[model samples]
Target: MAHLQPKTIVIVGGSLGGLFLGVALKQLRKNLNIRVLERNPTCLLHDQGAGIVAGQDVQEFFQRHDRTHTPLAVTSHQRLYLDRKGNVIDSEDKQQHMTSWDLLYHVLRANFDGVDSEYAKAPEPQDNEGTAVYGYGHQVGDVEIDGAKPLVIHTTTADGNTATFEADLLVGADGPSSTIRKLIDPSVQRTYAGYVAWRGTVPETAVSPAARDVFVEKFPFFHSNGVQILAYTIPGPHGAVAPGTRLLNWVWYVNYAEDSREHVDLMTDKEGTRHHVTLPPGGIQDAVWTHQKEAAQASLPPQFAELVAMTTVPFVQAVTDVISPAAVLGRDARVLLLGDALAGFRPHTAASTNQAALDAMALAEAVGRIVEGEDAAEVLGEWEARVLEYAREGQRRGVEMGQRSQFGVHPLRG
Candidate 1:
């Protein structure tokens, strides 16, 4: 009898979703080879200074997988609603954990491939474990799959060199603009939600005493006609969580009709380049940000306006929604779509990261069954059906919440 050969899995996209799946698979099966390909040329991704609401699944993932045990989030003890005058009108006792994108990315990278950084230290490599590789600057050009043959992935390096890789399975976690998703199903596309979020963050020490008092340790929100702004505390630079070192992250959602002149202008950066989804920090034009600040002063609560004024480099992200018809694709179901590639949810639900964690956890649970002589197609088919339902439900809830908040229309009335 011949010994069974280990299966090779190739994951495209080194962001949170891809990293989550890679780490989970590496931990679950020591004999499975995993390779992660990222299009970004640099090893470290940009911080973006975005805050993520750590759902239950996310916290559990870290607890189960992360060995460093570094404090991952800042806890918000209450939810507060303020009027235009910054006076609290209503409050509820609720606790939530907030974390930074950079911190989470670094922690996952450490766990996936034993890469050490300022935020997390890598652990010692396990004996008898399969190989784990992370390839940066590798932009996937195309994927080819033949029946009963290994999948072929073609890529071009940053230096313009081309290479090929073979894998038993291909996973696409490359986010909303995923190249793999397009190849698999080009019919699915993202639709803009008629609004955009103007986001910024300020250091805790920089906030005024009055502003700090109202926002610190609380998830604060202010809603006006067709607009909403919210804020929470998150880890600061280099994942610092100390009182003075933390950051107060804020996002203000404003309505803009699709393709309107105002929308076009807002999406244009200072360099005269138009962006589709996000305008990163330092890209916003001076006039655009100045106008937004003036609007904030007139419409936002005094504390919210003050925080916006203190922001040095504010960014903007266009809200969008996308739901694919299927999660598993191609002959024999060898290709898989995960995370935003599977469904791009509105930010209202704050379930994007949590959804990715859930997908990773579910797949990890299914791998053992497939390895134990179960039909691969049947097992993966079941997994796909479960996650696709989850993604659709999340997308539906996000749309309803966004309509109620942004358009002031209840789903029942509609």
Candidate 2:
């Protein structure tokens, strides 16, 4: 890698996936020019990724690279399953740590920029400063190779002007609606998994005492014939973990046949805007939220229902699955797709972020030889195989887990 190092690298999307790859590459090569482009006007974008289950890959990445690795999660040691009457039907002790999406994003953005400030609330960069730069309010407009010498990344600036950058390498971490993946193979698309998640978070201080008693310090799960719900605790804004300041995060997965009337209705918000990917918070119509709350009362245990009732703004994430035909694109292997851009999984596994971390590490190892013009085809072929296999297994596992929780679940299995 050191021998075949490129002069410049450009990464699209400033979320965890892109930032992690940028950080990983910087760690791998010193004085390597890197730049990250994000569509948000600022690195500060509000989120719906309420909580992340800490995985070893993300944990290790921070340990090895981050200058001031602050503890970033809240831990729970048990899982509780309850009945309609609020009695615990089953419980298991499996210690786990959870973090908020915003906190993780903030830390990574700061680390990528090598900035020491409250902007991302991460430590100052120990060495990197001018080596990498982050551009906000920039949307990637087009990416095409300039005759195979350097890949061109065309972006639309904040004021609607075009800007282009030429890089020896381009990483597409642009998330579920990845422009890079689609550009490489227009036929690839996400397949809806016949369900959607209603996710929300309420502050610990807002939780009723009875609800708090059941949900606090534990991950609670409740299921009826057609629904499954789980709730856990995560730190509040900016990693606030103190008592009464933490958030009680919940995700409720409900099934709806694709192309059914029910599916279309849920996909449309109050303003009649239909979302292709997700219905962001504050977009769910009041009537729809009311109906969901009523459903919660009928399907969930008393404590879980109470938690739902306390939510002021709930959001919906359509569960979907997708895998790219190729991770390395073009004749030269200069274009690459990582994270959600490469493979998107149903959230049932809670491992998408973990997958992103693993993808970054694996791609960093392959890039050196791919760009060196020696073993380009062989190295990229091996890299794509490893990433695709890993993604396929995770996607299938998520679908299996979801099926096991749905209304048609086989009685013999349980």
Candidate 3:
């Protein structure tokens, strides 16, 4: 009898990239063992991320894979630009689609976990000892590369205890404040874009009929004095798609000097905790929300102000950017960074989720070559050359778009 060691992959971060990588890899290579580690205590997270455009990259993947309880997105057939009073300044009949963050996350997670979900397709069986494992309470603490092939990953689990495992490949998909990226190269710090994104969602049944008629099944944009606001409808919690159950999602971006008192004030939560990243929903202080409301009434159109009024808990995400010079880590390239950990683009491009989908899809293809006996180093070279180009260009575009929205030139002005 002969014994064999199955190829193993450990993915850090169980959000979009990590789960997508696990599922894509499993779909591509059946005999491989995959593990995804998420620092979050549980899988049922809310307001961490919100609405996302249903891009071609993600839609392409989902077409071949249906793990969601239902279709992942809602379609909009027009683009409407509104003025301060809610007047339709410009309108176009263009088709688009969008989804809520929770919907995508739940679908990907169910596919990775092979679990029975409310609207999830039952995942394919592992059949053998091979598995697509998810570690919710486990957070990656460190990774050590041995020689060239396998990486030793140390993790701190829920109770402050530690554990270690060996993996043939280590992928860091941990997101914007990526621990893996920092550990790999300290120079790639996030650059705050002198602004923050205020986001919120309103249920279809909660708003007035007139507002619902305008916002439902449409993408709307508004501009005022260097501020940009956009809104679209998406599925409500748990992928609810009935007309009255959908959600109206909106994001408004406003500029502020980085680390200045103004910026600090906005990033501070109700309890005065200065959050390093975003002020999640319900964390806003009364004074801050009041200030924002006053500003909206002064600058935004009446309709937008009304939208803000209907919002129960608007959140804030500091606009920031990070692009790593290298994707493959370690002297021998045993580790790789993907998605936001590699480069976080501004929301302007509406490509963040697609970028992650691209990363997972590309990584899966690279693994296919390795399965055909390609050299690991050679595979890394090919993968990096292709993906970094897309990531860098996408990040550049996002920054450019964000700048235009805030300061470059106002679309409404033109």
Candidate 4:
């Protein structure tokens, strides 16, 4: 039996996957009414701090779908490994590229707006001629899709405003702790991975001139062991900044025993405090920067030590275990899950954003098929299959990494 095509989709999360899906769906189905629900109140300030490298396929997808006329600034295109002595051990100069997260978000946002512009400029004049627009600060409290059109939804927003926007489909692109998933499948939840991640970006000036030379000489940092950190500079707000003065980003992983009581307490800076950071929402207390820095200095080799020492400011992050067992969509298949909401890859693969972009493209194609009289369920099923396959591969690798860390085996070392 042929399935009903989804005419409306509600994307819950205005981050990478949600934004890209909005633009892609609008491009594919001009009449598709799309709304993005962002938990964040404002879009003025983007918190995406660092950059990542997208492979050829991802880059090509951007070129095909994104018509924002903005060119990506490639910071570097290689991953280099160095030993504790600050000497080069191995390098994969072939597969390297640098992309700031904020830059990608800006480009995608512009492209989404371009989609609206194209709709406005459409030669045809009708309500369904172009994608209708809406962005909500929704704290999705529930998702009940058992109705005639499968009214997958949220209860209300953070400010006590009730908004029940019904769509043919509901997309769960809301990251690891997806409320949509909880509403649909409450049994599955994210568990702790028994490890924590420490991350921060420092200005190039924070490091000595010699460190600057080393960084500019290479792009992404990695190691054969499981432990690896990538660092590169991207364009900052001001253009006149020195070449290395841009943000230098890195993440370090440390394993913690189950039920380990030792942990860093979250601290608040004083009124006049110069450096301050509120840990990301939902983040658990992590190892203190001082303790983490000392651990890195002691355990890591000299080359990594140099990078850690140079990072004047650092934030601790905890790793969690989360994965959706099955991918389910509405009867009409109007909405779907993408990126971390559906599947989260460990940072080791460095494929999180790339996977999100891929999800955008794949979901667009699937929705396009449904619009052309194909079975919406089948199309979505195929999309989910491909995405889940990639996700499973990533999880397999991540699990291996977690096991190695637990057993005192260093990650990245072959």
Name the candidate that leads on TM-score. 1
15-40 per-residue lDDT for model 4 (tens digits): 87788788778777458888888887
- Candidate 4: residue 337 Cα off by (Å): 1.5
Clashes of each: 0, 0, 3, 18
lDDT of 3: 0.82
TM value for model 1: 0.96
Q: What is the C-alpha lDDT profile of model 1 across 1-414, one tens digit per residue?
A: 011122788999999999999888888755788999999999878888898999998999999888778889999999888888888888899999999899999999998898899898998777645778999999999999887788999999989999899987888999987899898888988889999988889998898898998788789888876788899999998799988889999989899998899999999998999998999999999999999999989888889999999999899999998988888888667888888889988988989999899888787666656666567777788899999998999999999988878999432221
Instruction: State, as a TM-score between 0 and 1, how close model 3 is to the true structure.
Output: 0.94
What overall lDDT goes with each candidate model? 0.87, 0.79, 0.82, 0.63
Residue 212 lDDT in candidate 2: 86
lDDT by residue (1-414, candidate 3, tens digit) is 011122798899888888788888887645888998888887554445389998998998787655443678899989888877788878999888899888887788777776565656666564542578888788787888656446789989888999888888888999988898888888889988888899998887887766775689999888766789988899987788788888999899998887888788888988889986788888998888999988888888676777888788899998999999988887667778999988999999999888888888888888777766777677778888888998999999998888888987776631
Estimate candidate 1's RMSD in Å.
Answer: 2.7
Index of the highest-lDDT prediction: 1
Which ten residues in a row are the worst by lDDT in model 1? 1-10
Q: Candidate 2, residue 203: CA error in Å?
A: 1.2
What's the C-alpha lDDT at position 95 in model 1? Answer: 93
